[model samples]
Target: MSFTTRPTLQGTFGMVSSTHWLASQSAMGILERGGNAFDAAVTAGFVLHVVEPHLNGPGGEVPAIVATARDPRPTVLCGQGPAPAGATIAHFRSLGLDLVPGAGPLAAAVPGAVDAWLLLLREHGTLSLAEVLEPAIGYAAAGHPLVGAVGATVTAVRSLFEQHWPTSAQLWLRGGRPPVAGERFTNPAYAHTLRRLVEAGQAAGGDREAQIEAARRAWGTGFVAEAIDAFSRRPFRDSSGRAHAGLVTGDDLAAYSATWEEPATLDWRGHTIAKTGFWGQGPVLLQSLAILDALDDGAYDTASAAGIHAQAEALTLAFADREAWYGDSADVPATALLDPAYARERAALIGDRASRELRPGSPGGAQPRLPDHVRSRVTHRVDVPDPTTGEPTVRSDGVTRGDTCHVDVVDRWGNMISATPSGGWLQSSPTIPELGFPLGSRLQMCWLQEGLPASLVPGRRPRTTLSPTLVLRDGEPVLACGTPGGDQQDQWQLPFLLRHLVGGQHLQQAIDAPAWHSLGVPSSFYPRESEPGVLLVEDRLDAAVVTALRSYGHEVRLADAWSLGRLCAVSRDPATGVLAAGANPRGMQGYACGR
Candidate 1:
């Protein structure tokens, strides 16, 4: 067998994988206690918030894909909060802004992850709301060891926190200083907030579903909403170097609810891949897969320079289409874009040399329109001063690390889920002292320009980068995987899928393989810059491979040997009732547990 950082966990019972070891172990405990996959996933999701506070919090968002044994078809759980009713292009234009501020309340959407988790627990989970939330509350109330990266992230934004948002400094700093790595940190305020929600549910009576609904209500129309609304009224400094009051009101929170939707799917090589709809960047993967499927089998050779060139070229085309065609608007030509004919036509564009232009294709003979901002600007410096200021993977120090968390769970009953939870970084906005967290800045993904499919609009979900994947064979889910790299989420996942599904590598071996992603397309985060014909690869890749890629006219850049992807995955064998899982080793945090 080929070398791997760790063995792919194998078992007949249950499996859990996530970006953090504590979350993976806690979820495994729930499964060992006889809770189903949905219950375990919910438990892990909440625990991730408390343990990985620099990455995610109660106010972030999650988009997940879930499949149950009784209902094998994949379904999407959309916890992505929409832009508040007051968020509009005209309003932003009046502020003399061409882009949404990347680090303030003005960039926040209605908080949605908490409600979505509660909804899943109410409908699919067997555990009580309090039971699923217990681990997270304990971690927050007691303490958890702070990781080194959290300290580095805090140090990056220490000055900003002290000079502008004192509330944030008050929550993240220790005795007016940055916390050291491995220190035991506690957020008693967040523990109290969760305790209050549980109490509200218990007061509603004995029915579990009613209790969960009560907690959801408490978040939306109750104390949670009240705290956020009151805090948003105060102007706070942002990436724009100006203080602005937020657009999210309690009414907007009251009007929001997490909902379920059908997944967008594609069939290739006898397996079906499912993802969130066009509103997210999920379709970029489907589109890339389609483009690759039309090419020869040699394109699947991830080790070859020719193979890498083929894949990167295919991704740039799909990303171009994503920028022009994918959005929450009714005008997104979803069907036409995924058609086989269109895929073949797009594949025909790839050649021996790299093309340095953004090429968006016309679907169904209609003209493609890109945002004028994307077309006019070549590059701009974005002030992502800290992990919270929009792009978590891209830091001001030039280090590329995932500042988000991911979890995957699969039980013996065949229930499986893959969820990517992100946003509400401790540095995103001023922390609400009462709630112990800040609002998310997801609205920065939307352009301030009007009439575009992804323009800022009230009640519209900002096109997010939190994409998760669920794969099925013969109508049963076999694999679930996801990562946290903002715009690079799907791009990084593509290579893993190709290595495992097409190249016949085992789960851990596939995840351990060197990974790369093209920076030729526009980034989904703030500044929205693009580097045409650029490909970033891990330095561990074969020297000859990198040299050949450059010879193909690609602008190749080498990153740290193990600093590209943080993929978490779980898989189940349908015929034999066996399960397996793998987690990324890049950050020394991701772990997989099973028995």
Candidate 2:
């Protein structure tokens, strides 16, 4: 792990959670200095670039939702960069390629994280950008220890560093060798960038435009140029001997401008949730919540077997709808999916028995009327039973990737910042040369064929699996939580949320308890048929319960009791006015404090 660990806090109340403790402490310090949640979050976000660069960076996209105690509504900030102006499905087809990773400049979209941070401060923050950035600057300059996780990550992605950008390889690898856990590592270049931003912010009188301009000046060009160089290097091997340096140029970065649009809102179970329509998977989460509510199950508690089963079924259906019709709301109208009446119709069609033979369908709001008794020819494979021992075969692997971090800040003033910054699964975009972050491989997550709502297109945002959530009780936020797992994010979060909210479990108990994920639905990245109705469960599940589920014809895969998609949560008890924060014991860390 090439990251640092330490925790510190300043305000009347504060909590910080990240893979790296030093980065968390950086944010805590901001709060102690009277900076609000937005300030602390911004401080954390910038520091993460230096400590957890692989998971997130200044060059990535961030989709956030913020609600100030003073303001009644949560504001949605769309930080997911859009597709390059020239990108399209036909382009990939023309190149005779099934899929391409790190699409370079051609896949680049205007980055919004930097601008989003500024917007957050302008709206609900009380600290200056310079003040917020101090911790990150200090870390970058002083250096920190490399952890086992960070070391392993660097080794795994060595090809990315060696073959992509020379500068990246030079910065991350010392003497052409990846750092081992516990080794001290420094990022002076990144440190300089942070210092520049701090100095510029101080000069700008703290205006949004001035602050953003300073950040852009520090990050934009050099980052974008390195990306272009990386693309030119052709890091990954393809089927053909010839390496393709996808279209990307320095000019794109020069012209890139982060744009702010009016946010999207949906009423779910009578609570208004904010989403940036097409940008990430924000809209999808809302749609799923709406679908679940329409089911109107009077006994939807996490402890009840029926409740868990029903929620899983509902998630499957909602995901199906997402595959068919969700995309950049800028190009498609997402409001149609929010209609409650339509969701009710969709909920009515779900059957109890497994429908093994089913295929993808067109996007129609919730559920369109299907002809009564109309039989379709598509047949799905039935779940194969393991008869030898009357036990289902279950296997689990530790699959990991970079790109994703979530921060939830609740200030003494009652303001909150629920932001999830991500990117890096794919490298930084080459088209926007020197811009530090990569464009999302989000296109790969969508169906390529025409007629689907998420079909590839230029300048359109892909349907992302990243979702930052906040749970409110009696019109006040009770919990701010989220995780970082490409598509598995929601799959992991929904269950934990139920356990904590409905099952009355404490934050750690809900997060550490056994969890399960269904493979019956389409994956956000891969588009393959014959996805087994396999449910991946943690080892903690009782053997008897596992057998019971298998008897219902569901394949089960056993995962390590401790996995990285550990849930981080901050829970507030309204009655007692007590706040508790917990980090997943499965390798991740978290902290809590109050005045």
Top-scoring candidate (lDDT): 1
Please list the residue runs of candidate 1 whose C-alpha ends up more than 4 Å from where it truly belongs after superposition: 380-403
TM-score of 2: 0.81
lDDT values for all models:
0.87, 0.56
- For model 2, residues 169-211, the per-residue Cα lDDT tens digits are 6665778887887787776765665666667656666575576
What range of 10 consecutive residues in model 1 has the weakest lDDT sum? 393-402
Q: Mark the 10 consecutive residues where model 2 has the least summed lDDT.
A: 389-398
lDDT for 465 (candidate 2): 68
Task: State the lDDT at 194 in candidate 1.
Answer: 92
Cα lDDT over the full model 1: 0.87
Per-model TM values vs. the true structure: 0.97, 0.81
**Model 2 misplaced regions, further than 4 Å:** 1-12, 102-107, 163-165, 202-209, 216-242, 246-278, 294-299, 329-336, 354-403, 425-443, 446-451, 526-530, 572-577, 590-595
